[model samples]
Target: MIRKINRIFQDYMREKRLKIGKNIWDRKNKEKIIEDNNFIEDNNIKSILFLRYDGKIGDMVINTIMFREIKKSYPEIKIGVVTRGGAKDIISNNKNVDKIYEYNKKTSEVKKLAREIALEKYDLLIDFSEMLRVNQMMFINMCKAKINIGINKKDWNLFEVSLKSIDYHYHISNLYLEILKFLGIKNIVRKYDLFPTNYMIEKLNLKNKKYVVFNPYAASKHRSFNLENMIKISEIILEKNFDKLILIGTKNHLSELERIKKRFGDKIIIPETENILEVVELISKANLVVTPDTSIVHIAATFERKMLCIYRREIGKEDKNSILWGPNYDQARVIYVDEKVKNGEEIDINKIKIEKLKEKIDEI
Candidate 1:
């Protein structure tokens, strides 16, 4: 299949890039390297840059905790982040982030950013990219920081102080916490930081109305709900005696959402949102959130809102996503549509039946 071929090709390229990095960095930097995080304080590090070029909103949400905890521990340190794919909006108004660099994946743009960061002469650079991407590795090599720290999933010469391999038994957010623990941060609290505006509240006139947020779209088809299935689930929730059903999606989903809106009439309110922050404001005030596997799961978790999530897994394979990135709050409920999936195959969330959803809604 094309997906399998792409994976093989990507692995081959990653290995090739790693080899080139070893050759380039091994010869370029011959100075003594420290293996611990003491270099942060010993060198009197003032400015710290974090590389989060993966750019998924959920990953950015998870890293928000690191920005807050790091600032709490080192109040005088200046924090900077390099993010791509418009994920900069997640941390746009964050008080802990002093600077944010946007990478557009263009060679000229990246080189320009490198020059700009080099001029700042940052003291520390931290990379939480769990895997080696050629672009991220190249960017890390270009930044002129006094010290570099990165996750050591595989052997690489780029980092002076490499953190240990990620432990899959725990939540993925803990990896960011591990980075903080390495820097001697204590009493760390595992949570997400997202601030929303009052514009959405005022415009929707939802001062104190009870509502449930239904997000049926994700970045991938395998995780998104089809129109028919979404309708069935929506009807079930509407029968639960709630004030309203607020449907959410991107512009690409507008046509489908409009069809559902027409079917439900005034019962469904699909508010036009300017950005992801408006969506955050909407979710923060929701009585409950129902979503497929997506970043919304983490957003609802950030507010510790009552949520029900639909997830999928291979029949016989280990469910890595549920273990690592599942709901972080204790009050959340998740339903997996694995019974219909073939062994070792990706789960199609649309296959989840209406009866199963109704059961969960009633229980909640």
Candidate 2:
């Protein structure tokens, strides 16, 4: 199949890249992070900028969570974020972010954006993207900020404050929190927040119902569950008196959504929109969420909704919090599946043990 071939090719490229030592991270620079975090906190920063270039969903969630905690600690501080163009909508209404700066990912615009960033006069800068050393270096050198902080793989002298070098194997959230800790903000809570306006909730018209939501797609091929397995899960859930099933994802996932529709017909609801707030509002009304490791999972967690989080076994092992981090009031259960197959390699959906998932859902 085309999917199999694509996966094989991707695996081959990854292996080849690894063979050339392209994936290795520097180990020596891990100690500097602690020193940098300390320096930033001691200075009492008033304005801060968070820079993350690889603006994927998970990365955006991590940044949003960190920004929220930072705002809680330093209520007077103004926090802004700089990310690639498409991510502005994701954090547009986030209370923690006072502003957002969009930068083109291409090299040609880097210098121009760098200049714009330098003009901000931030008191502190936090760089979340690991490979953007050149970008961080430009910001540190050009920006008027007194303190520059971020994770570094190498001893990049560009940052005024940098964390101790770390292995790439760590969970992204913990790494992000470690950056915050390095800045003297201890007791950082690991909760994610997504605020959907009343108007947005009204638009979705999601009333009280024992509905289950499904997010069957992931941006990464390695992380997405099998579409067939997802369909089967939908069928099984519908059979269990959870008749209302909502499928959530971006426009790119329409085809996958259609596939589920063919399987479930009118039983599944596909809410299509570019707005994340709309999606958050939709998930807020659901009784339970079944999703791959994606932003919607975190959003559901914010709403204190019970979640059935599906994750690649490797990622699940790396961060226990991947399955557990949710709103304080709700319980979340994580289901770990191997990375080799899309969705547990055609496991029997009827036989799939979801007692834990059901228990969590019933708890609330």
Candidate 3:
């Protein structure tokens, strides 16, 4: 498809430009990132800009804890976020964020955005992404801010305060907490908040009902459980007298879930598509959630809903992605299986037996 071709071209161009920027163009400035790694305090800071390139739901949701803690510590300071275009939904109607800047992921527009953000004169700048994309790094350096903070585990650094020297050994949420501590904000947010307005509450009729929610898809195939297996699990739960199985997903997943509905009949409540708030609204009403290693898991955790997370060990090691991103609160269980297929690994998820899934389901 044309979309796939464009993504390939974008990645190629970004890699090419990063090579050029690293070896030749911005070599001196990159060196300067290492020379100044000490902490810099800004007592009169009033405005802050946050840079996050990966705008996936899970990425944004995890960072919501960071956003909340920052605003809680400094109620008067204005916060601006620069994220990939479609990801504005994560913080779209959020009251804590003052501005949302959209970057279309083209290397061509880096400088233009840099000039625009520089004029705002942010007192603090933070890069929350794990991999420092070169064009984004270049933009981070160009943006004028008093105290610049970037996180990386190694020699790569493009900000005045680099955490590369310190090995981060906590969960993703805790990692950000440590960064906030370094910035002189010691009070960390212990809770995650995703507010749903009355409009969102009235959007769905499933409120105050007993339903089991199923998130059968993920951003990548390896991270999702097999749909066939998902159906089997749904059958098991329905037999236990749960009200109904609700399947929530984005537009790309509509047809596949439609097929599931065709086979399962009215016992399944398959919504064609649900936006982030709608998903949150539905999950907040569900009795329990069965999902893959996706944002739904994290969001369910925020509500403290019981979660049965199914994931592939190959996608991440036990410590890195499994334990780190597993349910932050209580009442959650996880099952991992070795993957067999690289793309859309329906068989990989089959490695988890039906009885094992039922046991976890029954526990909830």
Best by lDDT: 1
Residue-by-residue lDDT tens digits, candidate 2, 245-336: 88877777789888888877877888766677677777777777887667776677677787777654443335444433322233667665
Model 1, range 25-72, lDDT digits (tens) per residue?
432262364445555576677989998877888888888998899898
lDDT of each: 0.82, 0.64, 0.71
Better of 1 and 3 by lDDT: 1
Name the runs in model 3 displaced over 4 angstroms: 1-19, 23-43, 153-157, 164-169, 197-201, 314-319, 339-347
* Residue lDDT tens for model 3, 241-262: 6767888777777787788888
- Evaluation by TM-score, superior candidate among 1 and 2: 1
Per-model TM-score versus the true fold: 0.92, 0.74, 0.83
Candidate 2: Cα lDDT at 336: 53
TM-score of 2: 0.74
Backbone collision count in every prediction? 0, 13, 0
